[model samples]
Structure formats: structure tokens, C-alpha cells
Target chain A: MSKPLILVTNDDGITAPGIRKLISIVNEIGDVIVVAPNSPQSGKGHAITINSTLSFEELNLDGPQRDFSCSGTPVDCVKMALDKILPRKPDLVVSGINHGANSSINVIYSGTMSAAVEAGVEGLQAIGFSLSDLKWDADFDQAEEFIKEIILKTLENPMPKGIVLNVNIPKLPKEDIKGIKVCKQANAKWEESFDERTNPHGTKYYWLTGYFNNMDESEDADETALANGYISIVPVKFDLTAYEYMNELNSVYQ
Target chain B: MSKPLILVTNDDGITAPGIRKLISIVNEIGDVIVVAPNSPQSGKGHAITINSTLSFEELNLDGPQRDFSCSGTPVDCVKMALDKILPRKPDLVVSGINHGANSSINVIYSGTMSAAVEAGVEGLQAIGFSLSDLKWDADFDQAEEFIKEIILKTLENPMPKGIVLNVNIPKLPKEDIKGIKVCKQANAKWEESFDERTNPHGTKYYWLTGYFNNMDESEDADETALANGYISIVPVKFDLTAYEYMNELNSVYQ
Candidate 1:
């Protein structure tokens, strides 16, 4: 049988240590190709380049996988990768091994998960991985085995249509890990906090800063799972429709 | 009591005619404040600026409302407005009078809807308004009464928490329009089409272009309502969790 084809990407730019680890892991499983943003696009959720043109250059990176960096958002990289670079439709699209957490409400602000969601939007199977640690030299070694296991399992048993997996590893060693937990997105958000500062030019500028507020600590919540030292996997979807509220909304308009 | 504080914003920049019309319509209804992007930020779905600084300048626009043009994405405008400009947490947040349609699947890629969704995330009553016509001089006069009715109704009869309204008007005259229909988002997507070209330096550059493909023609869908000459309203939620597939996904992981 032919090997599975995997496309790897990240929001931390092409040369980040995180993507390099992701490439190494997926290389053993499939014919891997890396198409990612040329710069860090951490909070660029589902953004695409509409008013601008896009360009990309091939790279001679150290890996069996082919890598190219595109001058656009993470979603744009996925769009451009599918249109220009790939020889055929990839069997699976995997993103990240990201440097920080995308466990709950962070998914909306995360470029890593947005790339995965964009792939899901295209009707392809995709997954996004993130570690709870933000340090560049953060230990990715612990996530290796479980990452391989999850990829192999996904390849073996495909998910339903319009669903992708968001996997966030706890910031603990492999031995300290309490195994994987499939959970729901926790009700969480960043409290809107902007740090106001003044520049030397006499004009005032502000920096967007926020404190992470985990509003749900329920057993099934991804935040709870992560806090309990388990890798949390939440089945993610791109459809933003609130199905439960439709009938009531219909009545209101009627 | 002071009138309802209605915050108005858009992805088409603060100076666009659509917003000017929106500001005029809402001026009679409430004490309004406008905080929108300095430039057009269409298709900037839910993006925020974490790695940079932001600046805004207040302007004395024609209405009772104060207007500020901020150097950030649509989502950024909402955050900044809440954190700095507004006198208090707003009574309502209204986005757009967008120059194009945001019915059905278009909501995922829309900065107009993103701004509304951002407001919804902050637990505010929010609504996004869009018109089917993309013309600079498209007629918005037809939507005045209904927009007021919806806003007034929304204030009097609050929608359930965490749900925002996505209202799209068809390109029809006031009389010919078939009033309003509350509906669900149609399953639709942009058929991936990239226009590849070479720059003067012989380097390849691409334009992100596509045809809108309406996959679902269900009578209750937003697209269907719009196509049949009625304004469509779909309740949008920011939570992208696939709740229906959770149990099955858990079993697969187990």
C-alpha cells in the first residue's frame, strides 16, 4: 500500500524549533511537506491576504520533508499550499507542536489551530498540536511518542466529516503525563486588558495584554484535563452556527 | 436613565459610507460610539494584535456619537473600545452595515461578523449587519426601518446569552423586499481558485480569488432567504466546538 501523505505547518514561523520537531515526527509516518508562514503569526485567527499579493520561496531545510515559507497568514499558507505546492491532495494535515497552549478559548485567537481549521474547511482530515509551555527550548521530547500514536490512530480510524482534533499537551514529562483525555472545549476567555503606554514622540500607544480566565473547571473540560496532567484532545469544527438557538430565534423573528 | 450605549464598528474602515449610514440610523436610537479600523480589514476573521502596539484618534463625526479610527483589526477595535474608549460596558454592540454579504459560510471569513462575535465573547448583546450589494454606492436606505426595529427589539427583548445576530440584507428596494427571515447558516464555501501570475522580477505571485459555491439550498438557510429577496438573520456563536461528535471521538481515542 502507498504511504500516507502528511502536510505539516505551524504559526511560529518556518524556522522555529517546534515545526522542526513536527517535521521529524511526521517524516517517519508519511511523505511530509512543510508549508508555513515566514514570520510568527500567533494571534492571526483565520486571516487571509485579500488586499495583497502572496509570494513564497523554496527552502533547503534539514529534513526528508520539503519546506517552503509563504509571506501570508497561516490560513493563507494552507490555501496556497493546496493550490500551488502539493502534487496531490494530502491524506492528512497536521499543524504545530506549537510553543504555547490552544486548549480552550485560545483556539479563536490561535494561528496554529486556524490553519488546521482551514484544512478542515477544505474537507481534509487535520489536527493541531500544542504544548502548554511557551519557551522556545521547551521540551518537545515528551510529546513525541503520543504524537506518533495519535497520528497513527487518526490514519487508521478517520474522523467524521467537518471535525478536526485539537490536541494540547500538558507541560510535564512523559513519565509524569497521566495519558490522553478526549474532552470538550472549556468555557474560557482572556480578560480584555490593554496596557496603556506613551511613546517618546508624545503620542500614546497601547499594548494588548490579557489574563487567561478559565471559566469552567468541569471534569470534561479541556482545561481541567490539562491541569490534571493529561493531554487534552477536543474535536474542533469550523461551522460557527448555534444550532440550539435556531427555533427560538425563528420565533422571535416570526 | 441614559439612552442605551450602542457601539458601532465595521471592517470597511470607519470612513466608509456604509458605517456613515449605520451611524445616522442608530443616532436617533441611542447614545452611540464608533470604534472601527483606520483602513479596510475585510476577511480578517477574528484576528488580534498581540505582538504590536495600537493607536486611535477620536473624531467629531456628524452624530451624537463619538468616532475613533484605530490602527488594528476589527477584533482589535472591539477590545480597545471596551478597555479604553467606552464610558462603561456597552448596552449593545452593532457592527457593520458591511459593503458585502455575510450570510451563510461567509461569516467565517468576515471581519464584520468577527467584530460582532468578539463583542459576543465579551458577553455583550451584539449584531452584525451586511448588504448583498458590494458597490460603493449601494442603496442602504431600504434597510433603515428594519435595522431600527431589530435594534429596538433586541434592546427590549434580549437574545439569550453568548449568541449574536448576523443580519444580511438583499439588494432590493424597500417595497420589493419580503421583510425578514430568521434562518440557519447555509453550508457554503469559496471554490478554491488562485490566479497565478509573474511579477516584473519573474517571481510568481498569486491573487486569492474564488467563486461562491452555495452547497445547501434548504429553505431555512440564510443563503436561500437572501436569494429569495428577504433579509436573513442567523444567530452566530463564537464557540467552534463540535459537541455532537464528542462521544464518538472519545470512543475512537479510547
Candidate 2:
């Protein structure tokens, strides 16, 4: 049988160490195509460039995979790849090894996870991987074996339609890792404290700053798993409808 | 008793007719404060600006409500409002009367809905309203009474935490419109067809374009309700965890 076709992309741009590591691992598993944003798209969520045009250029990155640098957000890259670049529907789509954790509430603001979610919306099996460390030079190699194992396992057992995987690794050594845990998204949020500052012109401006507030102490929560040094995998769905509340809402509308 | 404090915002920017209509209606219901983006932020999803500084300027729009135009995405507008703008926690948060439909899968790509989701994440009662018409000058005045009714009802019945309402009005005249129906998000997606062209610099560029493809024909779907001329109210939740598949996922991981 021919190799499985894999589409690889990330929000940290095509050249980020994280995606580079991700691409390297996937290359061993499938025929890889890298369509990633040309610049960092952290926190871009599911943004598409609707008001403007987009472009892409082929790059000679150090890999067997074909690389295309896209001039849009991470979600845009996935759309562009499926529409204008890929020769066939990929067997699997993988996003990130994101520079920071998208463990809980961060998933909604994550370009990394959004790309994966967009693919899932298109009925493709997809996964987004992130590390808890936020540094550009974070040690991605530490969890290389585990990442490969997770990808292989997922490719064998494709996720259900409209569902995708959000995998986050703790910032620990490979030996210190306590394996994987399937968990629910922790009920958490960022308490924003915008840093008010003045520009050189003496005009006031604010920088977005926040602290993660995790309120879920449940053992099955992703944050709890990560805190316990386990790699957390949360099955995320794009069907945002709250089915349980439909009857209650119907009564209210009446 | 003190009047309810309502925070108003939208993705169509501060000066759009849709938001103007929203502000007018919200002003009648409570003490209103509008903090929306300075320019249009269509299809921005749940994006938040983290790489740059943001600023807001007070505007003298023709209303008893106060207006502030922020230089950020819709989600940023909500975070800025709660963190630095509002004097106290708002009693309710309403977003849009968006110039286009945020029904079905469009809710995932909507700036208007993202703002409402952001408020929901903050544990506030929130709702996002949109009109089926995409025209800039869509007759938002037609559904004024219905909009007010929905807002009042929602204020009276606060949604459970992590849940918000996505309300979409059909394009028919107010009298022709059927009553509202609470429904689930339809199984739908956008079939992307990128329009490629040659730029002035002789480089190839592409425009993102897509057609909505609704596969769901269920009577209980939001898209179906809209097609039947009924206003659709879908209860949207942000906790993406697919709980039903947790056991299945756990087995695979093990």
C-alpha cells in the first residue's frame, strides 16, 4: 500500500521549531505536505482573510515533504491547502506542537487548534498538539516518541465526524512523562488585566495580559492531567449546539 | 430597583447600521454601553489581539447609550470592556444584529458570535443576534420588536454558565416572519473555491470564497428553521469536549 497522505500545518509559522519537529515526525509516517502561515499567527483563532487576498510560495525547506508558505492565518492555510494545493484528500491532518499550551479556554483563541477544528468541520480526522512551554526554543525533542505514538494510534483509529483531538504535553523530560490521559476540557478562563501604557506620542494604549484561572479540580479535567505530568488528550467537537438546553430554551421562547 | 446594565457590541464595526439598530433597541431596555471594533471584523471567529497594543476612543453617537470604538477584534472588545471600560459587571451582554447569517456552521466563523462566546466564557449572560440578509443596508428595523422581546426574555432567564444564544432572523418582513424556534446547529460546511489570479507584480494571488452546503434536513435544525421563515435560536456552548466519546478515546489511548 502507498504511504498515508498527511497535511501538516501550525500557527507558529512554517519555520518555527515546533512545526519543524512535527513535520519531521510525520515525514516518517506518511507522504507529508506542509502548508503553514508565513508568519506567527498565535491567538488568531479561526480568522480567515475575507477582506483581503492571499498568496503562497513554494519553499525548499529541509525535508522530504513539499512546503508551501501561506500569507494568511493558520485556519486560512488549511482552507487554502485543501482548495488550491493538495492533490487529494489527506488521510490525516495535524496542526501544531504549538509554542504554548491550548489546554482549556485557550482552545477557542488558538489558531493551532482552530486549524484542526476547521479540518474536522470538513469531515477530516485531525489533531492539534501543543507543549506547555511558551518559549520558541522549547525542548520539542523530549516528547518526540510519545508524539509519534499518538499520531500513529490516531491514524489507525480515525475520530468520528466533527470531532478532533487536542493533545497537550507537559514541560517535563521524556522519562518524567506519565503517559497519556483522555480528559475533558477544564472549566477555566483568563482573567484579563490589560497593561495600560503610553506610546512615544504620549497616547495611552493597552497590552493584553492575563492569568489563567483554572476552577476545575476534577480528576478527569485536562488541566488536572497536565498538572499531574501526564499528556492530556481532549476530544473536541465543532458542533457548538448545547443539545441538553434546547428544551429549556424552547420553553423560554414560547 | 436599578436598571439592568447591558453591554452592546458587534463585528460590523461601531458605525454599521446593524449595530446602530441594536444600540437603539438595547438603549430602551437598559443602561447601554457600546464597545465595538473601529473597523469591520467579519469572519474573525474567536480571535484576540495579543501581539499589539490596543486603544479605544469615546464616540458621540446619537443615542442615550455611551459608545467606544476599540482598535481590536470583537473578542478583544469584550475583554477590554470587562477589564478596563465597564464600571461594574454588566447584567447582560448582547452582540450583533450582524449583517449576515451566523446560522449553522457559520457560527464558528462569526465575529459577532465570538464576542458573545467570549462573554459566556467570562460567566456572563450573553446572546448574539444576526439577520439573514448580508446587505449593508439590510432592514434591521423590521425585527425591532422581536429583538427587544428576545433580549428581555434572555435577561429574565439567564443562561447556564458556558452557554449563550445564537439568534438569527430570517430576511422576510416582520409580519411575514414566523415566530422563533429553538433549534440545534445544522450539520453544514463551506465548500471553498479559491479564486486564483495574477497580481500586478506577476505573482499569483487567491481570494477565499465559499458556498454554504447544508446536509441536515432535520426539522429541529437552525438552518431548516430559517429556510422555513422562522427566527432560529440555537443554544451555543463553548466547552468543546465531546463527552460521549470519552470512553472510546480512553480505550484507544490505553
Candidate maximizing DockQ: 2
Residue A123 deviation, candidate 2, in Å? 0.9
**Model 2 RMSD, rounded to 1 decimal:** 0.6
Chain A alone, TM-score for each of the models? 0.99, 0.99
Against the true two-chain complex, what DockQ does each candidate achieve? 0.82, 0.92
For candidate 1, what is the lDDT?
0.91
The parts of candidate 2 lying over 4 Å away from their true place are none
| Docking class of predicted structure 1 | high
Given candidate 2, what's the lDDT at residue A179?
Answer: 94
Residue-level lDDT of model 2, residues B1-254, one tens digit each, is: 78999999999999999999999998988999999999999999999999988999899978799999999999999999999999999999999989999999999899999999999999999999999999999999888999999999998898899899999999998898888999999999999999999988899999999898999999999999999999999999999999999999999987
lDDT for each residue of candidate 1 in A1-254, tens digit (9 for 90 to 100): 99888999999999888889989999999999999999999989888899999989999988789999999999999999998999999999999989999988889888999999988888899999999999999999999999999999999988877899999999998999999899989988889889998899989999998898999979999999999999999999877778899888777778
User: For candidate 1, lDDT tens digit of each residue in B1-254?
Assistant: 68899999999999988999999988998999999999999999989998999999998777688999999999999999999999899999999999999997789789999999999988999999999989878899999999988898889878777799999999999998898998889988787778999999899999999898999889989999999989998988877789898888778778
**Clashing pairs for predicted structure model 1, backbone only:** none
Best prediction by lDDT: 2
Residues A83-202 of candidate 2: C-alpha lDDT, one tens digit per residue: 999999999999998999999989999999999999999899999999999999999999899999999999889888989999999999999999999999999999999999988998
